[model samples]
Target: MRTLRDDNILKLPDGRQLGYGEYGDPNGKPFILFHGNPNSRLLWGVIPGSPFLPGTRLIAPDRPGFGLTDFKEGVTTLENWHNDVIALADSLGIKKFAVFGPSGGGPFALACAWKIPERLTSVGVFASVGPFLPETVVNASPTVRTLWKYAPRLPGLFRVQMRFFAWLARYFPNLYVRMILTEFSETDRKDYARLKVADFLRPDRSEGFRQRGICTWYDAMIPATWPIPLKEIKIKVFLWQGKEDISVPFAMGRYIAEQIPDFEATFINGFGHFWIFEHKHMGEMLEVLVPPSSSPRSK
Candidate 1:
C-alpha cells in the first residue's frame, strides 16, 4: 500500500486555502481525485500497489468548505470549482493530470472535462451524478429521492436536514454510523464492518456542517441546475457503476455513459456505492486510467 501523507494546504492566488493530500509515488504520474459530498480528502485511505501501471500519484483535494478549506458558499459554481482545480494544478507545477470523481465529485470531474479538456489526460467518474431528470431522481433512495425532488425549491429544508445529520454525527457518532449503515447494501455493510469507516466520517461530518453549511447545501442542489455538456467532452472517460448502488443508483451511471461522447462504462454485479473505493475495485479503475504501455489491462 502507498504511504499516507499528511494534509497540505495551498494558498491560491485568490487567497483561498485549498486542502489536499498526496498518495503513492510523489514522482509518479498525477491523478487528481475529488471526494464525494460531505466528504474530505481523508476518505481515500490508501492505494495498494498494482502491476498493470508503473506508478501513480493520487492527489485528493477537499472541496471548498469541506475540510480545512474555506467555504465559498454562494460563490461556488461549476466554473468556479474548475478554476480552483486549475489553480491548484498550476501551483503544483503540474500541467496535465487525470481527474477522478466518485459520487458528488462526479459533476466536478465532468466540469473539468468540459472547461479544461486540454489539461486533462483522462477522466474517470464512478457512481457519478447524472442529469436530474424525473426518471433519474425516481431511482434514488427514499431520503435522497425526496431531497432531489424538493431541495432546489427548498434549500433551507436541505440545510436543516444536513445539519441534523451533522449534529447526530458529532454528538452520537455510533448511532449516526448505525443510521447511515442502514442505507448501505449488504456488501457495503460487510466492508464497513471490517474497516474503521466511522473514523473517516467523523471529521467531515462535524466540520462540514460547522464551517460550510451553505456549501454542503448548495452542492446537493447541483443536479437542479443546468445540465452539464457531457456530449462536448473530448477527453477519454471511464464510468463505473454498481448494480446494487442505491445512493447514486445504477441509472445515474447509465445516463452519464449515454451522454459522454467518449466513455467506457463498467457495471459491477453485486457492489454498491462504497465498494468502488475498495482495493479490488480501485485497482480496476487505475488500470483503465493508467493503462500499460505495451498492452492495456482488459476490463
Candidate 2:
C-alpha cells in the first residue's frame, strides 16, 4: 500500500492541492476510487487486504477539506468535483480510467459519468448513496437519515455532530466502532468482528477528519439535490446493493438504477453496507470493470 500523502500533493491548476493514495499494481490499469462521507482517501488503505485486481492501480483522492486537501468553500459541488478529478487524471497522464464510488462517494461517481463519460471506460458504485429525497431519507438508517434530512437545514448542528463522531473515532475507537455496528445487520456485525475492522478504522477516520468535520456536513448535504443530470450519463454503470443495508437504504440504490440509462445491478439478499466490501462482493465488483485475466479472487 502506498499513499501520496502531503509530500506528493498534486497541485491543481486552481492552486488547490489534492491529497491522494495509491495501491495495487503501480504499472497497471488505472481506477479512481471515490470514498464515502466523513472519509478521506485513507479509506482504501484500510481494506483488510489488497482486494484490488492484480493488474489494477487504485487511486483514491481526498476531496477538498478532507485529509491533506485544502478546502474551498462555495467551490465544492457535484459538478465541480469532476473538474478536480479530470485534473488529477491529467496530471498522472491517465487519459481514461474506470471509477468506483462507495457509499457517500457514489454521487461523485455518477457526477463523473455524467460530466466526463468520454474520459471513462466504466463506472461502479458499492453500497452507493442516491439522491436524498423524502422517500430515500425515510428508508435510511436512523443516524444517517437524520443527518440527511436536517444537515442542509441545520448545517452547523450537523457539523458539530460529525465533529463529535470524529472525536469519538479518534479518542475512543472501541466505543465508536460499537456505535457504528449498531446500525448494521447481524451478518455484517459478525463480519466486522471477523475482520477486526476496528483497528484500521481509527486511522482511516482520523485522516478523514484531519481537517475536522465541515467537509462531512457538505458531503451529507450535497446529495440532497443531485445537481448533475443522471439521465445524460452514457457510460454503462455496475452497482451492488445489499437489501439489509440501512446506512444507505435499498430504495436509494433502486432509485439510481431506475434513473441510469445503462445500468447493471446485483441486489444481494443478506448483506449490508460494510460487510459486502470486506468479502466476495468487492472482487465481484472489480471484475465488472477489469478484464477476467487481471481480476482478483475474493478470500
CA RMSD (A), model 1: 3.8
How many residue pairs clash in model 1? 0
Candidate models: Cα lDDT each: 0.75, 0.79
Q: Per-residue CA lDDT of candidate 1, range 45-96, in tens?
A: 4332232134677778888767777766566677678889988888778888
lDDT at residue 262 of model 2 (Cα atoms): 97
Number of backbone-clashing residue pairs for each candidate, in the order shown? 0, 0
Q: Give candidate 1's error at residue 270 in angstroms.
A: 1.7
Which ranges in model 2 have alpha carbons more than 4 Å from their true place?
A: 1-7, 292-299
Candidate 2: tens digits of C-alpha lDDT, residues 1-299? 45434235898888888988887766777888898867788887777565666667788898777888887887777879999999888887888888999888888898999989998878999878878887766667677777677788988788898888778877887887889777766767876777776676667788888876777878888767568777788999998888878888888898888889999988888777765556555666877887656533211
In model 2, which range of ten residues has the least summed lDDT?
290-299
- Taking all chains together, each candidate's TM-score versus the true structure is 0.88, 0.91
lDDT of 2: 0.79
